[model samples]
Target: MSLHEVHKSHRVGWLRAAVLGANDGIVSTASLIIGVAAAGAAKDNILLAGVAGLVAGAMSMAAGEYVSVSSQSDTERADLAIEKKSLEENIEFEIDELTQIYEERGLEPNLAKEVAKQLMAYDALGAHARDEIGISQTAGARPVQAALYSAGTFTIGAALPLVVAWAIPGDHLIKTVAASSLVFLALLGGLAARAGGASIAIGAIRVTFWGALAMALTAGVGRAFGVVA
Candidate 1:
């Protein structure tokens, strides 16, 4: 089988978080460095800035992911609680709710009622969880996992520019950082597109174009300020 048949597309859920984290890490850190370097910062000072950005960005990603996913989890819990209470108090109405849901999905009246009855009889809560509450195996809330994936991917992506800066000597650190970051961004875009089963060329071009623009703007700002300072 081809790579596409290797597994179900459900894995794309987690992969999305990792890709987003890495993309943000690369773009933000690279732009910050380019801007600062163009502003005529010393190599040592640029290194310091890059290091600081990496740490700060990773932590911020982790905290943000955790908080956002936690909110989703809270809402999901509240939904489940209400579903349980409704199932216990109004079994008939709950079945009717399920039947209506199926009918809305294009089932005939009799078929909708039969399907709802069978599904509810088999597992009442699972039916509501999947249909009404939008909680399924593919997309569920896991705050800690999301936080860790985001933090880890961000750190890895941010390290690319840092490593390039460290490898290249002297004032050319700015050029090296920008070049390496653009290359990395292209790769990231292609990889994300591959996973999402889209046009890799389009994704690469779009990501690189945006990243280049960001760097250009930052560099322009830095140069404008550098001349003044």
Candidate 2:
């Protein structure tokens, strides 16, 4: 017989970037549309704002994710380099360190030392990196992956409200956009939660709440400015 198990841990990197990008896309673009519409802007002007926001926000997300994840990757590489040097200079010490770590995790001393020795003999740097430094290939940072996921998801998310606004350019544009955007946000939250294995209702509610707040605040500001103008 054979046994297998599925894991979600590997999805953390790209999943986080995708969710953040999509959420920001829907929220910011929706808010911009609602605000501009509330301020008595024409349909073309409102959509133009949304288009501009989508472009700027997508670029911003891509650049930001790339830079941040690249920094993490750099740090990880630096740490690995140092660990490699340490292993070369003091191989025995490295083995003992791995043994101690295994012992701390409930293995007997003799067995721990044996296991560490075999593992280090097989791949010293890899053993230390995994057990001592907690870096692994599955969870390691990838700057290009994060950047592409963020930019792609942001564009998809931002397009939802933009499409809605374009479709219904009438007196009820504000109501339609706001309502539909909330629905889109709730769906996004639910899907993201499902993908991340979290409570769907909670995720949906939290995302919707923040999105509503953002749209409301922006709308209020737009209305105030409209009144003044």
Candidate 3:
């Protein structure tokens, strides 16, 4: 029989993108809807704004993730190229470097060299990439995956307030969305923290606080402008 073990580090890539996308989608869209509704916008106009926000935010998240991750991927490729050239030109030096890395990690000198030799024999490029260049196959960047995750998550998060707005009457839209969005945000925070192996309470409180601040600031601005104008 074979057994498999899962670790939280494996979720680092997509989880981060997902959580960020969902958080932004919920907070930004909800804040926008609440602000516009508070400013006495018509029901149709408010819904239109929410729809527009959802589309724009999703695309923005995708593009941002793609560009950022692509940059990181590019740097990783460049470093790999450098490391590869170094290995090809001077195998001894590369082995020596690997030996030193293992030594620093607390292995004895002769054992470190032997272990490095065995690892190199198994997969020279992989060992060098993992230890010297700090790039691992598990942590490799995938721009497409990141972009898709972010965009999809953003759409899901942004839809919550929109759904609430559509279901409720105009007179109650602002309050309904405010309450519902806060609850939604708290839930998202807790879920994200749990997935990332973090404290649920801290995550929930942190996201809820920021979400409240964003909505409050936007609402204040809308109310002030509505009254003044």
Candidate 4:
């Protein structure tokens, strides 16, 4: 017998949070370091800025993920509540709703009704939640899980530039950080795309373009201010 295959959609929650957190960490931290270096800041100051960005970005990502996922969880709970109440008050109507849904999905009317009856018999709430409201256990929101994943990934990505800064000479700091960050962003994009079964080239290009733009803009601002200061 062939083994059952796991689908990528199952990882949607953590994958999205991790990718966003990591991309933000790399772009923002690298931008900060490049900006400071452009401004002729001391090497020690640049490292400090990168470290600070890592800490702040991780916390921000965590809070943002928590609030956003919590709101989604609230909506899901509200929907489930409504579904539950409808089932308790008028099961027949709810069954008809499910039947129609299956009918709309190409099942014949009689077959749809039969399937709906069986599903509702087995687990009415589970059927309604899955078919009617589009909530599945795999795709359900988990606020705490999302928050921790985002924060942890952000720290990992942000630390790359900091480590590079520590290992390199001050004279080559800005270029080194910018180049290395682009590579990191590209790799991250490719990996994320691969995980999602998307085109790696497209993902890499998209991330690299944005990373380069962020660093360029920050460096320009830093240089302009450096000259002024």
Error of 1 at 91 (Å): 0.9
Alpha-carbon deviation at 93 in model 1, angstroms: 0.7
Best by TM-score: 4
Model 2: per-residue Cα lDDT at residue 62 = 100
Which pairs, if any, clash in model 1?
Answer: none
RMSD (Å) of each candidate, 1 decimal: 2.4, 1.4, 1.5, 1.4
Per-prediction backbone clash count: 0, 0, 0, 0
After superposition, candidate 2 runs with Cα above 4 Å error: 227-229
Please, what are the lDDT tens digits per residue for candidate 3 over residues 27-140?
999999989988888889889999999999999999999999999999999998998898889999999999999999999999999999999999899999999888987789
TM-score of each: 0.92, 0.95, 0.95, 0.96
Off by over 4 Å in 4: 227-229
Clash pairs, candidate 4, are none
Better of 3 and 4 by TM-score: 4
Quantify all predictions' global Cα lDDT against the true fold.
0.87, 0.94, 0.93, 0.94
What residue runs in model 3 are displaced by over 4 Å at the alpha carbon?
A: 1-5, 227-229
Candidates sorted on TM-score, descending: 4, 2, 3, 1
Over 1-229, each residue of candidate 2 has an lDDT whose tens digit, in order, gives 5596777788999999999999999999999999998898888999999999999999999999999999999999999999999988998999899999999999999999999999988999999889999999988999999999999999999999999999995698989999999999999999989998899999999999999999999999899997436
Pairs that collide in candidate 3 are none
Provide the global lDDT of candidate 3 against the true structure: 0.93
Clashing pairs in 2: none
RMSD of 4: 1.4
Better of 1 and 4 by TM-score: 4
